[model samples]
Target: MDTAEPTTVGIINRENWIGALPAPVREAIEARMTRFTVAPGMPVKRAGEAATRIFQVETGFLSLIGLHVDGRQALITIYAAGNCFSETAMIVRREHNHTTIALTPAVVRQLERDDFWELYHRHPEIPEALCRKFAEAISRQMASREQRATQRLGQRIATMFANLAEHAGESVVGGETRILLPITQSNIADIFDVTRQSVHREVSHLKQLGIVDKRHGDWVVIDSERLRQICSY
Candidate 1:
């Protein structure tokens, strides 16, 4: 078991780290972690701000973003639960690498790089936790990345919906599969390396084709099997 020390009363949830690591390593990290939460649209890191901590999302989503000279920001990554981030700032403060924004009400556990390294050295498994989680759903992420890279906007959207059904989709009342797309259009653009207007038009096209539906800020896939056959994810 990790033998560092007792955890702080209200820092990171000890359970999460313990769950991610072997017993001993978990104990090591539990001694030096802290936790915090953020609301939707809040900045996790500001432009030109220093990077100081790394975070793992426990719930909801975070957007890694870069700003253009004109003060407009483009999404870079939409990080979901179990993803680690802010490594650049955690070890040494540098100019803000990217602006991180909360895409929804979110809970996160964080540690300064120094503390993180201390724990990481003791627990080799911590670094792999994100990969482990992603691996659990590898087929889906692979198909998604493939679509993002090789497919046109329409095909990307279609394959995404299809993959969701097999990966995270749930059956609805009419025996149709629904997958939640909690990400923003800007972030979708980032995934496909396309313009936001392009994504907007493609999404509109998908809607018209009855491939999916949006509800309460989430995209629910409607005809995933058909979508897969046609889109070829």
Candidate 2:
């Protein structure tokens, strides 16, 4: 996490930003780009730190978390593989809004704030894409906040499962079946803004109703389409 060496997002060398740009322009940006490899449980940036760099994730998950006044953290959002975080930090050139933490071993590419501004000036389309991306982030945050404020515990929990399925789920060979939730119930509770005990009880209810079938280890899936229909409404 020490921003000292350049190897932040090790595998990010392959990301394509300006495919239509002339060769020289792309070369200029890539020359200044740097990558790094970081381990799990490392802090990428702390709250209130000067936003020195924008981070693009090559692989793994990153958490944007708000630490409560009582010292506990409420995870606000998760950035997955190929998505970029900390971009707005450079856009505003201000302090970080939330702490960024790696959930697993990850690669993060860094672009200095000044370098980003330079790139934006030369390639206007890049800035437009970044603007749209930031807007989407804000909209997602607003939706999550609204859902947390108005939804019931069961609904929020179900929404969490759906979000995970959208981002991380993989299809099993069982004829179009998909699986992505490898997290324990407690971790799922943390993600859903609920108590672990609540998740345990609700999971029991899901099992009883045949909404989810728990397999060996952390594997679980919906064997029936009825699960999705009931949870969605």
Candidate 3:
């Protein structure tokens, strides 16, 4: 990874954590941030490593991987641009519980643990923003657990794609929406706690229905409404 000095302008905006802060507070936080770039397939932070910093993704996608004692790895989640993460580790003063790996060439900004506390104490808005972020994460976690418990395999898969299209999709030609992240069948399988073959079958079904397809190696939602309808049922 190559590190860069802080810039005068702040990158935080209303879309992400700490972005909703006042301009001066955002600038103050940005002043303490150091930017870095990571190559695809590189580990941004490893499990068991000291968590002395909080990170915000400026570009590209990252995978949060959870490792078990049985030597198994699971995809916990994906972090895209404008997402901030690792705050829990920093807050609890614990080592990272999961590994973060870059899925594509990514630019990230990190604020040291010490600087983070200083800002937290100095700015009242910081804690409020963090609380909101944590709440959102918890809500998503609960929804995911519910989804895994109550939904069928195919329904879960469709719901995952629909959620991705809403959160991380870019409009493409011909009314299609392409998922911005470079995700694989294995990744989807990991997220759903299912086998890759199972995911492949569901993906094939979606393709046959003309609801989704791959274009230029990216997953495209051909009919967003139809995909959502699949999720609804």
Candidate 4:
């Protein structure tokens, strides 16, 4: 658990789900949210814990990790700044299905389940908006699964980098896109259920082609158009 101090202001971001709400509703929700900071590698929520709050990332990256009965763990997904998650569990009144850990120093805002319901009751648009968000999320997950199932290893790796660049990349000098998050070959291997060496091979090939490179420990998409062409199926 994080013991960081919590604040009540500056919680709304137009990019996040909460910002889609009506102005009055956004203010109400913000009033109920508590923003706090989390250190890298710290657990935000763990499996089997009651889903008492819904979280929105303000900054940094968080990885959702799922565990298998045989003691194996898999990376479900990574959430970046301006993303909201864990609503499904809270809505269903069930325990969290996965563990969320900070991949970098993060700032997050959480709204308690009871407060969420209060707002839900008052605002009719809330559920409809959430339904649309859930649908989009499911569509992305299905596409990712399909890619993993049918795409060649190199294509899969390329596609992964392209998607990550969209989600976490920032434009830099020379038109390159730098993925701000710390992603490793091992993390890619976990996502595709492949060995780290295999992921390294694909990454090295991309590096050799000058489609991607690393700068200051972050992955940089040197040639975004070329990467897209490679990932196109």
Q: Taking the tens digit of each residue's C-alpha lDDT, what string does model 4 give over 51-95?
A: 999998877888888875787777767876767888999898999
Worst 10 residues of 1 by lDDT: 6-15
lDDT of 3 at 37: 99
Clashes of each: 3, 8, 0, 0
Error (Å) of candidate 4 at residue 80 is 1.4
User: Which is better, 2 or 4, measured by TM-score?
Assistant: 4
Off by over 4 Å in 2: 1-31, 145-151, 172-192, 213-219
**Clashes in model 3: which pairs?**
none
lDDT of 2 by residue, 61-164 (tens): 77667876898776666666655667777777889989988866888777787897888898776786666555655665677667667776776666555546
TM-scores for all predictions: 0.68, 0.74, 0.85, 0.84
Q: How far is candidate 1 from the true structure (C-alpha RMSD, Å)?
A: 7.8
In model 4, which runs have C-alpha deviations exceeding 4 angstroms? 1-15, 68-72, 171-173
lDDT of 3: 0.80
- For all the candidates, what are their Cα RMSDs to the real structure? 7.8, 7.2, 6.3, 6.7
Best model per lDDT = 3
* TM value for model 3: 0.85
Clashing pairs in 2: 7-35, 7-36, 8-35, 8-36, 8-108, 9-36, 9-107, 9-108
Off by over 4 Å in 1: 1-20, 91-93, 123-149, 162-172, 176-187, 215-217, 231-233
Ranking by lDDT: 3, 4, 2, 1
Model 4 / residue 181 / CA error / Å: 1.9
Candidate 3: 10-residue stretch with minimal lDDT: 5-14
Report the Cα lDDT for residue 206, model 1: 78
